[model samples]
Target: MAMNRIADTTNAVEVHGVVKHYGETKALDGVDLAVPQGTVMGVLGPNGAGKTTLVRVLSTLIRPDAGSAFVAGYDVLRQPRQLRRVIGLTGQYASVDEALSGRENLYMIGRLLDLSRRAARLRADELLERFSLTEAAGRAAKGYSGGMRRRLDLAASMIGAPRVLYLDEPTTGLDPRTRNEVWDEVQRMVGDGTTVLLTTQYMEEAENLAESVTVIDRGRVIAGGSIAELKAKVGGRTLHVRPVVVAELPSMAQALDEYGVHGATADQAAGLLSVPIADDGQLTSVVRALGAGGFGIAHMDTHLPSLDEVFLAVTGQRAGGTDPTDPTDPADPTDPAGTKIEEFAA
Candidate 1:
């Protein structure tokens, strides 16, 4: 079978000069975005970067103070009802009714979307199997594990067969294994012709699932492009070396510096030393120099610049400290009540 096309410019999501403010705070500072149909666009940023706020505006849960947006050709401001018809949103936390069985939760959402009783049951059953929740379909969601709950949450979002899905930090708090599982599901959805706009703090997640990324910082878009393009903005590939013994760390660091590869650091916790290089040509010189210096290398890998480095370089902060679920402007651009309102809007 021919592979489904990921995105088409003829039909897509579009945002223009979008801005939202609360008193003195500008939650979304003239943000603009475009997501081609059937493709995944990863929104990357730190806390208070307005990622969730932008999601809310696109999902139609909150209106922007200025500018306009469209989903599947329907205006977000004037045609919210029509836009909602083609859109599904799954937030950071599972929104399934805990007291209800997994099947019941899916059925309920189907009903709300106007599916008949028989159709609702059939849809629920189909999702139960697809999400690997068939065995637990009859169980209350409250008793389900984190991964299962997340799957069910995604299943619920699909009940209406939405063409566009907004996953705002959907895997936030999931263990690495579970996170990978969610990523797999997202890939499957995109393969099946669903357009996904994912907001995430996990650089790995964005790298794995997103065809394009837009970096937001301080409520404004600092950068936007394909993953390779964004990585290029951060410079060339990174040369990572892991010595066999901790005692070799100092020598490895010095060797990296000798090659003019600065910012070399030893992560004792990971037992690895890494440095950024200007190009792939530096790799051979690095290996030869390390070997000549008598530094025994247990493992070495050269990788392109990751989104984590892009985040740090663009935002001037690390990823772990930024929480998209609860964004607060440490700069205090807005008043207490205004911040609360913006938080709720998110």
Candidate 2:
């Protein structure tokens, strides 16, 4: 992870008012994204949020009906051929040939990128080792585990040593441990000076991988900022109380307010009361006040608002994923087919 390996580009990827449509469905409604050099920018939204569509447009697979985009300073439309040379794309699914060995897959990709036979083989070996697939490089990818296959697929994308990489839900099907491994690779890639545009529907994934996030919903950006800033929109520390007697909820809310707790809400059905407490001092005061008000506590806990809650608060929907079946679609499989070929190694 040497910093010198990094190729410097101030804004690796930039887009302005990108617009696209599928029949009557507007997949991207004037979307704008900016990814700085050697950093990770996450695109977060549910299934039909135009995340995939934007990735496609930026990667040169799909042209925006309106607006313009650039990758590695090359125009996505006018200089797409040149842009392809400096950018790599790994779709939602691992597109490596299952019948080929991990080494073979990467070698083939290198060759396709127009690397000489020896150069392709050497690059393939390096990628295999870097992604920890050297031992199993000879084995058919079909035999590899989910995580290993994903690693190989990612390595294939790196065969050309792309300066800007687009990863669409890179860990979609992997377990938590495997996903962490993929995240580690991404971290390493960026540390070495690669600019990454990562698209994911998972809130935790966005929080873990992104230096900044652009949130899109139904093909439009509703929010864009750092994770902390987005979370702040939902307010701060929250204290939850389960009263021994549900009837005392209102009295406890009043008591908590007297103790400087803000926005106390009660749920009679669940016999629970929630208060937004500024700090531990406010929490302590609220608890003391509850005791003084003759309210016994069944249970209590303090927690900051979660990403799902933030999504719900902003978009009025859960963050499970954008349901592909929705009227508005980004793309199928996060990889729109393209004929822009990478020349095979001579």
Candidate 3:
């Protein structure tokens, strides 16, 4: 492997031609990604697509077989010790100790990161209040709700005020309200100049939080861009029309096809006709044609291709499942967080 590519100084995280393997398995085959400073880059893929392996490499939990990666102005391979200090990682499962109190967990992490006892205590108290855990700060983590433990784990990651945070499925099984709370915290971190790389199975979460997204499948990137850019790249807006009379569906399809509109499809079960529209002008033309044909519309709307649809079209698979190579499993000895504090202090 050769380091012929120049680093992108503006990016808080940059990876190029990264490859990793397990026995004969090519978990990551030449994956490339970049996340600009102070923004979120969503990594999406089906199970076993190497999403977690890439995270482990970037976080310095494991080394890549080839290529290069730089985070927070430090090379992941050459500057791993320095890199560890400026980065925080939270995996799919909450890694906080259940026997410890919420406040104690944060304080312990702070202390391990080399904060003075007084400083660690102050930082713990600050985070407990910031994450709205002050009321339950003294309670053992085992007794806390799922959402509470999640917030505490997140708070632990921020104890060192990292410059880059890696959140790998941070909101996996939480309810909607708790998920939104986690989203809010991520936004706040980015607002304060911390870069974030998020990997998740939820399309809505990516749409709401990611400034840009990169889709990977089978250890390679299939698509990469902002939500709008990816949607446009996949296909243009689709016009959905539901006629008031179920019997008129056939007529409506014929009318649309006759109006020079191509690829119009009818779903008999939903009683709706969908066609891809090239532009707003075309949408208007279709509406006028429908009106002139005496077709009464019950509902009509147009929207760009959704992330979920884009993912399926590009990867030929749905967005979520278990990634066998992912070390988020508690039993996996290579779990990134296993020695998080020690690595940070080193």
Candidate 4:
């Protein structure tokens, strides 16, 4: 796992004008975000966008150079000692003790959190059962599978029943099935009223769990909203058409622009012009306008914007190429045929 992944999380964590710098590099620059309670707040950005840095600040591992942050009502900088009590952190790698049994590890964490010996034992057992690690509770961490260790780590995080949880790319390398298991555990956490903050570059992961997202680039916010809202900026549903006659290009482009279409892109080489429309009705409007102009339409298609488009439009980075850890992430949109997308209009 990279850090940790939150599943169907609910609630908010806020950062206001948060800034951090390393030497001459500004890792975070006047970044502001609001995540409502009971909702997954996915922070999407490329490498060096200060995602991990922001996570470190919010988790109280490092103090910010400017601005303030709050997690579940505690100030991240001024009250880190108090903040740590209400938040749980599960990084990419499991933080459990490899020399001890899972039961011992969880119990130790509970004890460190100030639980009585008997209470710690009970809490450890309960968490083991909660995460389906009961059967392996007595086994040393080194003997556990990748998934088991992660579950143990998550259980340790919950020792204090934190109000807010920070999951930093929780499933980077796990198999699909194991990842799903971890996701299930996160869902249960939100069900009990824990707010979650997640930082991930995985588009599918964000789509599956986040209700809204804040995308950053170069330590600044590039976009922030629900997936639909972000896509809307890049033309939620785009209409692409080509005129069989080259002479119709200007007329088509003009008519579409006159009709109030926003940001129409043209590829004259292919005799193609594309514009983002509000919906199918606008597609009808374009077709009507073109017909009124006597332009013969060769072909037209309408499609929803992909997340890759959103990333590219805002960050100037392809989703695949940005993650330095694995540049060949197949989830990118640079494939020969583009992403396999559903045609909204034909």
TM-scores, all candidates, are 0.79, 0.75, 0.75, 0.68
Number of backbone collisions per candidate: 0, 4, 1, 19
lDDT tens digits by residue: candidate 2, 175-239: 99999999999988888888999998777787788988888865788678887777666566678
Range of the 10 consecutive residues with the lowest summed lDDT in candidate 1? 1-10
| Cα error of candidate 4 at position 251, Å | 26
Q: Rank candidates, lDDT, best first.
A: 3, 1, 2, 4
Error of 4 at 150 (Å): 1.6
lDDT of 2 at 83: 82
Please provide, for model 3 over 1-346, each residue's C-alpha lDDT reduced to its tens digit, 9 standing for 90 to 100.
1243234468989999999989877778898999998899999765566788989999998999999999877889998888888899988889899999999999899989999999999999999999999999999999999999989989999999998999998888999999999999999988888899999765667777899999875577777889777665667678999889878887788887898877888888999899898878888888988998998998999865654456545443222333546643212233332242233224
The pairs that clash in candidate 2 are 46-322, 47-321, 47-322, 111-345
* Residue 152 lDDT (model 1): 97
Per-residue alpha-carbon lDDT of candidate 4 for residues 125-168, written as tens digits (9 for 90 to 100): 99999999988888899999998888898999999898788888
CA RMSD of all predictions: 7.6, 9.7, 10.0, 10.8
Model 4 TM-score on a 0 to 1 scale? 0.68
Model 1: per-residue Cα lDDT over 165-191, one tens digit each: 999998998998988889999999999
Better of 1 and 4 by TM-score: 1
TM-score of 2: 0.75
